[model samples]
Target: MEKLRLYIQIHQLKEQGFKIAAIARKLEISRNTVYKFLGMSFEEATDWVVSLGRRRRKLDRYQDHIVYWLR
Candidate 1:
């Protein structure tokens, strides 16, 4: 399924009161993604989906700066 359509369907499931983890299991995606969709406004989720598929990231990339700046 395409990302946008899937997003809309997930949004509906959320409105119907399904838990995030259950939706993720049914959809075969990550629990974090489901929870994130649950928390985001539609516009925010749209922008997020558009941005999410665009790149790779590593924890180490941000950790260095955070560790340097944080106590």
Candidate 2:
């Protein structure tokens, strides 16, 4: 979700005539990240973010145990 928001903001700033370096500074992100996001289309960005959510974390195996403990 956060990445999606950042991607949108990057594009908006770009459209508003902001330079890539300026956008990186304003957003406090690395220039490379800004470039990477700008290179992706909206649909591709959306899919990338969605795929991130679907990735398995190292702690994923303990998820059920963690939830059971919390309860």
The candidate maximizing lDDT is 2
lDDT string for model 2 (9-50, tens) is 999999999999999999999999999999999999999999
Q: Write the per-residue lDDT of candidate 1 for residues 1-71, one digit (tens) a residue.
A: 27667778788887788888878988899988777666777788778777877767787579878898996
- Show where candidate 1 strays beyond 4 Å: 52-71
- Models 1 onward score TM values of 0.56, 0.81
Candidates' RMSD to native? 8.6, 1.9
Task: Tell how far residue 17 is off in model 2, in angstroms.
Answer: 1.2
Which pairs clash in model 2? Answer: none
Question: What are the Cα lDDT values of the candidates?
Answer: 0.78, 0.97
Residue 63, model 2: lDDT of: 94
